[model samples]
Target: LLTPAVPTLTGLMLTGCYKFKAMKMDVIGVYTNKMSTDAYRGAGRPEATYLIERMVDIVANELKMDPVQVRRLNSPKPSEFPFATACGLTYDSGNYEAALTKALRIARWNDLLDRRARARQEGKLFGVGVSPYVEICALGPSKAMSAGGWEWGCVRVEFSGKATVITGSTPHGQGQETSFAQIAADRLGMPIEDVVVLHGDTNVAHYGRDTYGSRATVLGGTAIVMCIDKILAKTRTLAAHMLDVKPDDLTFEGGRFSAKGKSVGWGDLAPAAYVAKNIPPRFEPGLEASSFFEPENFTFPFGTHIAAVEIDRETGEARIVKYVAVDDCGPQINPLLVEGQVQGGIAHSIGQVLFERTVYDEQGQLVTGELMDYALPRAHDIPPYEIGSTVTPSPSNPMGIKGVGEAGTIGATPTIANAVMDALYPLGVRHLDLPLTPEKIWRAIQSGADDRGGDRIPEADRSAPRYTAADVGDGALQVGNV
Candidate 1:
């Protein structure tokens, strides 16, 4: 709530670009009798998307408008880049409509009528929901944030032309190690195998803000690029001396410097520079450079996600049938890694919506303190994700790249929540809060109440299934009760 990361989820997207025409959000952070809420996964963005998306469905139900059409009507057009919102924020670049259209096509949204009708005949609840989300990344212009939002990088080339890169952003399973290495390799025109990226230790890694808020790649990788530019400049100078030509006349490619048909390979030039036997005057003996890059503005990465789910009315258990996501994080350096991020982030959001919840007793004692008390979603809980991307390079950055680490998490939560609400539409259920447990769903279904005001449940509302030890049986559905 207060002073948490991303104090406002996405005010620019909520007030500026969302097609709602009229919208207002009032956030009040209050000290709770329970555990203090803080950032997790997508942080505040997921919660905001969930509530806004749920409101969209609720309004759609009142107006009988197609949810997809409603979204399409309200979103900003592709030409609306640099769109300013009612809140004090600006969207850098996005094609929100394109992403939504891509997700819908991938999800086969237009063909859902027959599917819904067929499910109804089978006495089942099948619903589809879409969420278009925008995230502000790159940790930004620095002025907009309280923390020092800048990245540092250093690139060093040994006598053997082997490259080592040190970045400020440390990788904690987000593939920063590999991605930063790839950037160095590509920039140096060296084999990917020869490039090594180092981070996580203060002695080794540059002075960095560390990893969080999807800044590792967008900001950290850019810092690497900046440092490599310095390395390349030094290389060109030494190569000019070795090739016996002016540095301006030399054109380097494939890790070789050529001028006037005279060529010098990286291996030859690196050793010559370090040896300093025949090098440019006043030049350093080794090839090394550092860069501290400060972005002028934050990069905005936006996307759309669609979730199709099925609910078993008999038990109020829901299962995701299909999931499609179209994310645009600007020119992906590695598509394979981006795909992994999208899938993994979706899993994180699904866990938050369907299974993850923290509990506390009335006296403020932690109730769900252990892993056994918390219900994290398993691999089987997440359906296969159909992932797609459209690159719209950020004009503010040199690499035109944005962050995708949190995009999947930001877009998937509301999409799944919306789908679940849609699944229970026939039962007069408008919304149910997070960790949509079966008991809560069952209670909402049976009582026809929109019990979504808060996460606090009465003691009578237990977390376990309503079967006692005596009801345990081998063949039955546990005494035929749920």
Candidate 2:
């Protein structure tokens, strides 16, 4: 729908809202002080994405629009590079249309009706749901930072050639080690294993505010490159003195210095410079450098995801059958490591959708104390997922890279929850809270009943009796039943 006959109109399209076929010109109502927000996985995107996806099925049933077609109507086209969404984010680069198209093809969205018919013939509720989203990440640009504090990095390559990286960003799970090493080694032309990453020790890694806003890569990685440049400058002077050549005549390569095609290297020149025997008297024993880098703006990474599910009407239970994700984080430094980040993030979201939620009692006592009571999704809970991507390099850094650490968590939860609601729609359910427990789904399944609201909580399924502080010892417990 955004592909207008007049190119000027494309600039004003509300792509995300258009894609969902909904318009709320006054959505800023949720931003008030008291009820505004706090942090959670995926932040606000999870809630908004869930809302759109659930509404897709609802609108489909109401006006009979096919869910996929309804989505296609609003998807931003591949040609919309640097497109600006009404939310005020300039999507630097993306292929939203292709991502959605690929996701639907993989999900076999066209055959969903046939499968649903077969399932109905066999007495089951089946449905497919999709959510396409984008993440604005890699905090930076002093102006962006000034708006919300700033991110800082101080990279030092010691006199001993040992490296220590200090950044204001602290990572709890993102793999900064691997990424930092790649940046340092490639820039210095040293073996990757020789570069060491150090952070989180303010006394050692010393510097700014801290991580959490995903600022490490664009800011921190660029600082490593700057430090390498400093090291090369000093090393070149030392190399020129030892090689008996002009400073500009020497070049460093393969971890050594060469005099413009002459066969001598920096290793061969090191011993002479150390002894002051056959070399200049003013050179140092080892290479070292340090730097602090701050960029001009944050980069954006985006993607699309599709979730499919099956609901058992008899038990009111739903299970994710398949999850398909397509993400673009721009220029991967390590594909394997990137895939690991995406996969782990999706699992985190899956746990949130069907199993995990922080709960508190009326007395203000925390109810879910232990892992067992918290309802975490284990390995057996998630179905196999197909993860793929497309690259749309970010121009914010020389490496042309963007962050992938939180992309999966940013897009998967809503996709799964939306699918669950789609499966239960025929049962007269319009909305359901997350952690769709079987009892809640079963209650929704029986919403159309006139005689009874399904069976009462089977005594077996009622909340298991609660244990009190007086009921147990360190290694032994008292039980009334069993």
Residue pairs in candidate 2 whose N, alpha carbon or C atoms collide under 3 angstroms:
19-74, 141-296, 168-210, 169-211, 170-211, 257-266
Error of 1 at 392 (Å): 1.1
Off by over 4 Å in 1: 1-6, 10-13, 16-24, 449-482
Instruction: At residue 237, give the lDDT of candidate 2.
Output: 75
lDDT of each residue in 238-257, candidate 2, tens digit only: 67776678988876677677
- The model with the greatest TM-score is 1
RMSD of each: 9.5, 13.3
**Prediction-by-prediction clash tally:** 1, 6
In candidate 1, how many Å is residue 110 off?
2.1
Q: What would the per-residue lDDT of candidate 1 be over residues 344-460, giving only the tens digit for each residue?
A: 899999888888877777788888898898888887887988898877888878899989888889899889988887776665565677878777777776665344443333333
Candidate 1 yields a Cα-based lDDT of: 0.77
Instruction: Provide the lowest-lDDT 10-residue window in model 1.
Output: 473-482
Q: Please tell me which predicted candidate would have the highest lDDT against the true structure.
A: 1
